[model samples]
Target chain A: MKRLTLALMVLMLSACVSVEYVTPYDPVIDNGIREYKESINTLAKNLGDQAGTEAGTYEANLAHYNALESKIDLLIERANLQSAGRGCRLAEGISAQLAKVAPEPMIQTEEGDSYGCTERLLVLVKDQLDLLQNIHQSADKCNAMASPRGTKISCLRATTSKAAMKITNQSINAVWVVETAKKNGDNG
Target chain B: MSVNFEQVLANILDSAASAFGDGWDSIKTYAPAEFKKISSQIVEIAENVAKYQLNDNEGYSAQTGKLLLQMQRNATEGVLVAVSTLTLIAVQNAINAIFASLRETFNDALGAIL
Candidate 1:
């Protein structure tokens, strides 16, 4: 009886018993997902200023990216709900998409809208970001499935090179609008 | 999804009562009503959110969203304020119960001695 009592005491103290409904916060996953959403939005907003031309495409891209960011937030919330279990698949997809875009440097265009350039540069950035988000989302899923933290870190790193390649491959155009925005102080 | 949140709430109180060990049961009764109020508030906010979904870029609807967001913030800030304060009363009640139990056990021992 003493041993059983002592064992029960330990279980309750640790909160490790088979208690039907206990929600434990997993800080790493929670904070990391939030950080991903914030950074992706920052990246999207920053993308507009860096566009090759002042066409509608840049603004459209910004809207698309914002939508994506919102979706990521929802996915992360779902993941949190199942933090101790299998976790949400949507969370994994978003992370994967983010990893792809992390290293891809913003590409500028030499010709502005005056040169008849449609300026699809922002779209490229969005696609790249989406790729990274996908990978990161998958990583979140893997982490949820009894994954050790050590393995999860390694998984995030595995996609680093793909991101680096796209970013490094870019030939930055002199017509980068982001610098101009900063100079002129056009936040909106 | 009318999950009898009350039952879930009741269970929590039951476990809490067991932990308290005394006249705490009397005081513990107060918690269900408190939880019920919280549940109602949460439901109201949820209903309000559903009634007027906030815009994406705009966050919440400026008119409705702002009110709801402020309400949400206030609720978040205020949620534990009541529960935690009441918890002290619970602890006091629990202490009183344990003391009473201890007194009875000791009285039984004294009676045997007599």
Candidate 2:
């Protein structure tokens, strides 16, 4: 009779442990991805405004600026999907841990187990944001030089060209970060 | 008239380059190594800008415009690679100063042309 009681208690405790392990944590990644997307949108709007101003006199450069805006928009979408996929994987990991009845602690400890990669992702996004802001400032400076009598067209052209290249570089960086995160998640 | 325009443009680019070089020399020693790489690139870009014959071709504006664009890219690249916040801000300030001096030179040339 005592053996039966001991067995039942052990089974109940294991069940409880499994339930604890499978419980999903709040999706912090979702919030981070949202914030990044918002920033990208803001940058796109600023670039669009600059493109509008430049369209009157510098149609060729305006086309380049428009292309940059499109690239950034695509990047934001790709990043959002990648980040959401990562979040899903993390949740699945928790579920797998529960199914295996692994004795290890839950996937997310108090210290934030997913933070290493997430923080790296955030940093990369922030870097892109900084570059965009710099481009915006440069565009503003170019606009200031657009007076009717003495418009510094060379300066405007230079600023636009610089902005285009910077955006390209930043887009490449964003793609790299997403690829890296996907690889890391897959490996885990 | 053509020779004079060429001379004037050359002189403007030279003065701009010298001013930029002086500004870079003052700050390069204190800048981080990554920024040093960028500063070197900036110098090369300035040299290229100065080499263009602004009076010989109708595309003179386009050519100089491209070099200035390259300069901005180099500066942005520097900012991206910066390891620390302080280094990023410093690099940005250096770039702004460089561009500011170049812009002043361009304004002077505009004044002369007018």
Candidate 3:
């Protein structure tokens, strides 16, 4: 058991740098995992404490959606953004795409873990992931987001380039898994 | 009084030594009573896990946080006992002491009920 845990840890350490969603190596994009779990807990707590209705639900749902939007601030810490020129572009793209999403009702949940809340939260997660997928695809085509830190110029000229797309893909996949953890936790 | 609870606690401490890590040996000298008490708690919680799981998963779940919370709530008393003479390495050592103590308490309470 310890060996498996150690092996998993090693694999995750390496894969975390690589950027795959289901790598079994990475532990859900370090910061991303922590933030996502917090958001889920917050959303669930709100739902449980609040009344049942669209307005009540939206107020709770907005809390999570707002968190997703704020994640763009993470890019500021990445040195690659300054030289790549794609940083601003990537940020704008993410903003524009995510803007369309609103909390909606989840039909049925197959998430890996417990539903932990009403269908309302599930739909919100799924919708944001759908938008994130699009943003990732758009970014991947440019390849601008991929440069290692401290680089003056990178392979991709645009901020939302293909490399940035990869991060988007990873973010989406991570969010999707948590969103559907009830499905993955049980059925997957 | 009866000696069953202390023995129950000792058995659990043996089990808890695994989770408490190597530092426990040194930790024991400072607050032998508290250490023994905490070890017993670990055993108690494990015992409860079996009983509670068999009866009601939710009930078992509720106790999970309570064990730790109760320890924190009574930190002044139990902590004094646990750290009677030990030189602490870090704040986490105290947390570890509490965790060990709580787990024992949980196990004991659960075991009696079961």
Worst 10 residues of 1 chain A by lDDT: A112-121
lDDT of 2 by residue, A106-144 (tens): 233333323222333334444444444344434323333
lDDT of 3 at A17: 30
Each model's chain A TM-score: 0.25, 0.35, 0.25
Please, what are the lDDT tens digits per residue for candidate 3 over residues B9-41?
A: 565456434434555565454344544554444
Query: Candidate 3, which CAPRI tier?
Result: incorrect
Candidate 1 CAPRI category = incorrect
For model 3, how does the per-residue alpha-carbon lDDT over A120-158 read when each residue is reduced to its tens digit?
Answer: 222233333334333322211111223453322111112
- TM-score for each predicted model, relative to the true structure: 0.21, 0.28, 0.20
Q: Per-residue lDDT for A15-109 in model 1, tens only?
A: 43221111222343344434544565455344323322222132334565467556544534443344332211211222233233334312222
Ranking by DockQ: 1, 2, 3
Name the top TM-score candidate.
2
lDDT of all predictions: 0.33, 0.38, 0.33
By TM-score, the candidates rank as 2, 1, 3
| DockQ, 0 to 1 scale, candidate 1 | 0.02
